[model samples]
Target: MTYTIGFLGTGNIAADMARALNGSGHKILVSQRNAKTAAALAAAMPEVTIAPNETVVANADILFLCLLARTAAQVLPGLPFRADQTVISVMVDMPLARLRSLCAPATDIVLTIPLPPIAQGGCPLPVFPDCPALHRLFGDRNLILPQPSETALNAHLAASAICATLLDQMMTTADWLAAFTGDDDAAQAYVAAMIRGYLSDRPRPGALPAALRGLSTEGGLNATLRAAMAPAKDSLRNGLDGFRPRLGLPLGPEP
Candidate 1:
């Protein structure tokens, strides 16, 4: 059945989801907190309308709380929601208990991390305590993975947060290439294509060590790069370990 989906905060994540679900036959209502963004989204998608947060929450069949943790905490208490409405949240650090307390009238509340790639149908979307609405809307276009526990969900969260480091590395690599090639466009295109192929060829999780060893030929470019970045890799790991505490989760091995 078609549902009216509302987004409380129309930020990048919400906009991405709204864009992906635009023509999926669901009426999307967004709040006017960010008027320019809301208006832009309405113009870009079908059946997307801008409304007040109160109206959006009250009328929505499924409401996605996409606000930052602080904003959500401040705004959610005053919103009116039906006991039957399904609530989904994209805020990373908000606990399930806190969400339930704040959105008590809503019987079904799901916690998920809707990554930006879903907007382009690129990767699986992660949800905890599976909900049918997630599947009904996004399953066809992308993989809808209903994680069995929040522990598994946090692994996805960690990966999502690592994009900043990856981008930093990629830009550095591209810059070095451009320095040698003297052509920025050629350098960027080459680095992007190489990275795409590398991602596509990565081994299954359990066999990563073997795959890494196999990919680095003795005296090859991969080996040389690995050697050069060994120290940096250690530093990067130390930096990423900090994310777990911020999200209120234990630091541990990622799947």
Candidate 2:
């Protein structure tokens, strides 16, 4: 079914969603708060209309809250949100109780984390409370991982924070390859393709450990490199563990 989806904030996330939802038969209404992004989206997707937040909220069947936490706190209360409309929030660190309070009268509120890759589809969307609206809208292109609880969803959000660090490491590897091969573009392409291929080849559960074990051949370069990077891996684990308290998860068992 088609939806009149409105974006409350026209930031990068909003832009990406607009791109993803383009041609989905949904009437997309994006707020004019971020003028540049909203304009760009309207320009790129001629079907998307730029409107004031009030108009967007009033006309939309489903609204996506893509604003910064502070901006949301300042803006949401003033908007006219209908009780029948569905509201999905992508605001990081915003608690669900606070959101529900701010978006009162609109009882169908969903919390979800959508990555930038959502623009091109195939991104994993971690959602709380198992929203059917989300599945109906994005399930065709993305993986909708429904969490058992808000805490589980928050943990997924915390885990997603590691994406930047992983990308940084990929870039570093690409730079090293470029230094050796004298071909920057080729180095980047090769590194990206390598990672993509590896991931695509093992897209099933338990594939990670199996892949690691397979690659760790005795006396091989893979084993040597894996051993050398053991500390970095440990650091990644420690970093995730550190987020437990902040995400309301208890400390894991002692290692």
TM-score of each model, in listed order: 0.91, 0.95
What are the lDDT scores of the predictions, listed in order? 0.84, 0.89
In candidate 2, the residue pairs with backbone N, CA or C atoms under 3 Å apart (3 or more residues apart, or in different chains) clash, namely: none
Give the alpha carbon lDDT tens digit for every residue of 1-99 in model 1: 788999999988888889888778889999996888899999988699999999999999999999999999999997898899999998988988899
Q: Residues 7-57, candidate 2: write the lDDT tens digits.
A: 999999989988998888889999997999999999889789999999999
Q: In model 2, which regions exceed 4 Å deviation?
A: 251-255
Cand. 1 TM to true fold: 0.91
Instruction: Report lDDT (Cα) of residue 107, candidate 1.
Output: 70
Global fold similarity of model 2 (TM-score): 0.95
Q: Which number leads on TM-score?
A: 2
lDDT of 2 at 110: 85
